[model samples]
Target: MFTGIIQAVGRVAAIERRGGDARLHIAGLPLADGKLGESIAVSGVCLTAVAFTPDGFVADVSAETLACTTLGDWTVGQAVNLERALAVGDRLGGHIVSGHVDGAGEVLSRRPDGRSERFTLRAPPALARYIAAKGSITVDGVSLTVNTVSGAEFGVNIVPHTLAHTSLDGLRAGGRVNLEVDLLARYLERLLLRADGGGVNLDLLAENGFLKQ
Candidate 1:
């Protein structure tokens, strides 16, 4: 698991296609203690390091990952948010991020908000139900709080620090981003699902204010 805090902004050094899959070599990651077979969050998608060098490492991306994320569109020198897996006793700086992209979203718009910037993004129809106002969501591997929700869209404020530290600085309208909704929300939906109608009901959730209307 990852904490969704970006440790470094690495660049795609090379991409070698192998049939439907591809191998990626990333540079600029400060992974001094990194080892082969270690999991790393590469722009919100957990990828394993198959080879390692002082300045970089290599990982394989499957065809499914390519179809689900922006990794397929990556090119040499493309900046990517990088984070090592959370270690024992490490501080949970941000919300728990599984580094599993649930779906991809499109940047709807971006505008200034004081020293920060407010970005609105449109989530996939299937993933929209998992997003909530004030809930945590990972966008392009950066964990952010949703300030507002409107149907399939939500807005988040990106502080200057986050903008400078990650690749989100390059975000623009019409751009696509990898999104991972809160893990709790995903599990909650599963808990409510039932084939025998024996699971928790909306009335119970509504009594606790979990559901509106």
Candidate 2:
């Protein structure tokens, strides 16, 4: 698990494609060696590095990951958002992010807001329902809140601090980004599903204006 707060912006030093997997050696960040097996969120997708080094680490991207994320597009000199796996004592500065990307999304457009910027991303219709104005979503490994939602697209306000700290600053229109809809929303949707055939729709706990609109 990760909080979705990017700790460092690492640069991709090399990528070697072998068979259906790719081995990546990333640089530009101080990394610790993990026990043979460990999960790290690289640009919002949880990946396990089979090996490590002090300068960086190596993670293998399977064909499935390549098809589901922008990892396949990464090349030498590219910047990537990096976050370590959540530890017991870590602060939850960002919202809960499982590092399991739900779907690939695209940047629709961007508008400047002085030191900050506003981005609009178009996600799949199925993922759109999980989003709400002001709800939390993880984009490219950075946890951000939605400013507005419209059909398949949603608006996000990005402060300069975000641009300075994550890979999002380099995003361009039409660029693909890894997206993890709120983990809480998935759980809620399941509860809703179980209620559909039900005894009592406990969702009424939220129905009747109990949950803020």
What TM-score would every model get versus the actual structure? Answer: 0.93, 0.89
* Candidate 2 lDDT over residue span 1-213, tens digit each: 999899899988889999988988877656654666787888898988777778778888899988888888888998889988999998999999998898899999998977789999999888999999989999999999999999989999899989989989888899999999999999887775644466335466557566665
Error of 1 at 33 (Å): 1.8
Off by over 4 Å in 2: 195-213
Question: CA lDDT, every prediction?
Answer: 0.93, 0.87
- lDDT score, candidate 1: 0.93
Kindly provide the TM-score of model 1 when superposed on the true structure, using C-alpha atoms. 0.93
Model 2: worst 10 consecutive residues (lDDT sum): 193-202
In candidate 1, residue 98 scores what lDDT?
Answer: 96
Residue-by-residue lDDT tens digits, candidate 1, 1-213: 998999999999999999999999999885778888999998999999999867889999999999999898889999999999999999999999999999889999999999999999999999999999999999988989999999999999999999999999999999999999999999988877776876787776786799997
